[model samples]
Target: MEIELKPINIIFIAFCNNPKCKNTISIDVEEDTPKDDEITITCEECGNSIRISYEVDTI
Candidate 1:
């Protein structure tokens, strides 16, 4: 039997509005597939929830 694999290409970046809280998160997903539609990011420091859509490249 033979098998093939595909490279995973997914990049993520987090941006916070609060200047006092310097929290910028970045994540890279290295899997066989990319993200479907959107990605969610949660802030550990401020407890903030941010939903990022695939359409929006810049955050």
Candidate 2:
């Protein structure tokens, strides 16, 4: 038996805490992802880790 794969779309914006390297990051996640989830991302330029949280409003 074979399983079918479906594509999911997610939008996330992560900002670096480093003052010298204030970079914005975007990430794609799976379906039904938590809106009020905290995601930790590492900065490539500054090599610092930052946490970001956001909410998704469903209509």
Candidate 3:
């Protein structure tokens, strides 16, 4: 049996905007994958939510 693995190069980090609790949000995505226009991350400490938006322009 043979197995192959590829390096993980798709990672992004985001911090919660809640001043009371600033937590790290880690997101993993596949290569060449179309991402969502917006993302929401919740803070584990303070139970706060933060939203991240994305914009794309096709040329």
Over the stretch 1-59, how does candidate 1's per-residue lDDT look in tens digits?
Answer: 87675555677888865666779877665564344576767877787777877642332
Worst 10 residues of 1 by lDDT: 50-59
Local accuracy of candidate 2 as per-residue lDDT tens digits, 1-59: 98776544776778877888878877676577766677777778788887767665654
Better of 1 and 3 by TM-score: 1
Off by over 4 Å in 2: 1-8
Please tell me which model should have the higher lDDT, number 1 or number 3: 1
Q: TM-scores of all models?
A: 0.57, 0.56, 0.52
Candidate 3 residue-wise lDDT, 1-59, digit = tens? 87775444456688877777668887666545554467666777777777767543433
By summed lDDT, the worst window of 10 consecutive residues in model 3 runs over 28-37
Poorest 10 consecutive residues by lDDT, candidate 2 = 50-59
The best candidate in terms of TM-score? 1
Where does candidate 1 stray beyond 4 Å? 1-5, 30-34, 55-59
**Which candidate achieves the best lDDT against the true structure?**
2
lDDT of each: 0.67, 0.73, 0.65
Runs in model 3 lying further than 4 Å from the true structure: 1-10, 30-36, 55-59
